[model samples]
Target: MRGRKTDGDDERLPVISIVGLGPMGVRIGHALQAVKTRYTLLGHDVDAARVRAALGAGAVDRGTWSLAEAAAEADLLFLCEPVDAVCATLAQVAPHVRPGTLITDTAPLKAPVLAAAAQWVSEGVAFIGGHPIVRWPTDGDARPDADARTPAVGDGGGSVAAPPAPDAGSAAAVARSPA
Candidate 1:
């Protein structure tokens, strides 16, 4: 986030931060990069290796080891850790986040995550518990229950396909969460 663009540099471009560089997080970084929208991408993770991978892949513009520091720098902060770690991570970053920062997550379960985030909701800050539901077509190998599914990391291929590039409207869907 050290070199992230400021208003003087580019007012229209946003400074985005991803808090966990694990699978979903890194993929998200990639997706954001693939989009036409202009934004600065920053990433962090407990496992430094993940952050390195994200940076090497050009997913994030910069990677930092500090959670709170990243939170404070973000205009849009994404919680990319596994569901189990979401609550603790939320606690750590909440106080440091700039007001009006829109925080979202890739955690599968929204109810509990939203409930945990509910305590932090305030005037300018908003939390949206979101996950990209990776749906497989119905077939013998189908797992229709989205909640029970885990992300398929590798399919013997070296990389996973990024999600379809999001339009500006889709990315602009951040609003006050019902939490």
Candidate 2:
């Protein structure tokens, strides 16, 4: 996404909050930085050490332990947790999310998460399911290190699948429909 110009030649950047700091989340944070997107990245994790690691690695501009604080400030929220944990994390932040905040997940499975997000829709949250496919070298492989500057697509390629557009209502309502 392009940045919008503001007064005095400054640009307004988007704020993206990433709620997990594991392998996938760190990879995403690096990807965003590699693309040079002018976005303020906020990193949050239940484990404070992970947040610190992300911050130290320049994966995020800020780190927080509070889910509500992250949800309240982010224009976009990425739930980068395990499939089973996604719903619970969403519930924890649903009440704090601002209207029109776009919430998406990187969970491999969507059915369960979509089902649980319905309640969030009623609370004015916009949720969409996203899965990004990337191939990584397996252990014992002799391939060179992957370049962080480029997208991670290789012979073991996969495609991203996004669920149907969420309804204008609460997340709960959107969950009931087939994607």
Candidate 3:
């Protein structure tokens, strides 16, 4: 039967740390929370108040004042600091960070952040750049059924298209994995 064909699937979500608990950081946390399968969220900031605010907002499961504690256990660390603070924060935190983790910073100016990421490269970790084209207010949270699907492109015209429905196995992967 069709029902009997689907049973075994358990994909663990990676531990994610958000370094700056600003608006973007809050939104990222909200989106990951909306996905709601499993993940350990470590959030930190130099401001003790921001740490408390993120925890109070339910944006992070745990909040720490120590950057070292946040970086040690994360599989991916998102630096959400202000444009000017990104490089300085990286300089302080990069040395103690774990290998093989994905490091991303959300500074408005790309050039400086890019240069800093390049300078702090380690053997196992990958430094990538990310900027959210869309912005959200501090009070907002991600919609629970936000429909996070990639749209396909139409060939002849400028119209957008949708991909074919994935199989049950692929559907399970999409449900459990982080974007």
Number of the top-ranking candidate, with TM-score as the measure: 2
Q: On residues 1-179, what C-alpha lDDT tens digit does candidate 2 reach at each position?
A: 32234347666767789899876676677667777556788889999888887787777778999988888777889998998798898778877888868888889888888887865544456787777676554553421222322334222344354543444433432112122
Give each model's whole-structure lDDT: 0.66, 0.70, 0.62
**How far out, in Å, is residue 136 in model 1?**
8.7
Better TM-score candidate (1, 2) = 2
Candidate 3, residue 96: lDDT: 70
Task: Give the range of the ten consecutive residues with the poorest summed lDDT in model 3.
Answer: 148-157
Top model by lDDT, which number?
A: 2
Candidate 3 lDDT, 43-150, residue by residue in tens: 888878877777777778888898887776678888888867878877777777777787777666767776776676565676666655443323454331122121
In candidate 1, which residue pairs get closer than 3 Å at backbone N, Cα or C atoms, i.e. clash?
Answer: none
lDDT of 2: 0.70
Candidate 2 stretches with Cα past 4 Å from truth are 1-12, 140-159, 164-179
TM-score between model 1 and native: 0.69
Q: Candidate 1, residues 91-163: lDDT per residue as tens digits?
A: 8887888787887887766666766676665547767667664433345352212211233322121222121
Candidate 2 — which pairs collide? 118-171, 118-172, 119-172, 120-171, 121-170, 121-171, 121-172, 122-170, 122-171
